[model samples]
Target: MVENPLETETLARLYLAQGHPEKALPIFEKLLSREPDRLSIRESLARCRDEVSRAGREAAVNEKKRLRILERMLARLTGSTPPEEEIPAAPAIQPPRPGAVERRLAVLKQMLQRLERSR
Candidate 1:
């Protein structure tokens, strides 16, 4: 039976070499906290953190693109308006007041009487 190796530094380096930087991140971070003077470990931790951030940004962009594609496909399947066809928000309009409505009716009646007199 082979005993499993449990060296934290070795395991961290192994994770880095295996392109699993995210997995190595916390290990290096803890190791750095313990050995703050270790420049190599600090650099490794920084690199891992940068890689993780870049990956997160790339994933977010990919998710946005995937959602856009899915939205277009759903619009096509359901015969709904596409994103590009989305209408601008309508402007707010106040309802006509009773006095304003009555004023307009009176003006229209005056115009009608003038039209009849002209005829």
Candidate 2:
């Protein structure tokens, strides 16, 4: 089957982000054949290789967690099995965290922006 370059690139990057650079590289190479001038794609492919070399799984792990959150959120809202892998290692975080300084700062920034817009 023929694969679209855009889709292949996207999936390759996604796979690399999910700690599967082995899976991603081939797709990226194939994508390169189709879009040899895309520097970002090549850069991501290189980054994927770099990620494999480093002793880090946090980015991929976080990605898994986020994918799970979306899946669970969808499942709760619409009674259907999500098409993504669900990582259930951590608790879900809300945007409006009760006591976080950063959250408060973000709200204040939004308010300040609104106030500025009105002036």
Which is the leading candidate under lDDT?
1
RMSD to true structure for each model, in Å: 16.9, 14.0
TM for candidate 2 is 0.39
lDDT of each: 0.85, 0.78
In model 1, how large is the Cα lDDT of residue 11?
A: 94
Tell me the spans in candidate 1 whose CA falls farther than 4 Å from its real position: 1-7, 85-119
Best by TM-score: 1
Which residue pairs clash in candidate 1? none
lDDT for model 2, please: 0.78
Tell me the tens digit of each residue's lDDT in model 2 across 1-119: 76664666778878877878877877777777778999998898788777666635766778877887887898978988767663558877767656788878899999999999999
Write down the worst ten-residue block by lDDT for model 2: 51-60
- Rate residue 84 of model 2 by lDDT: 62
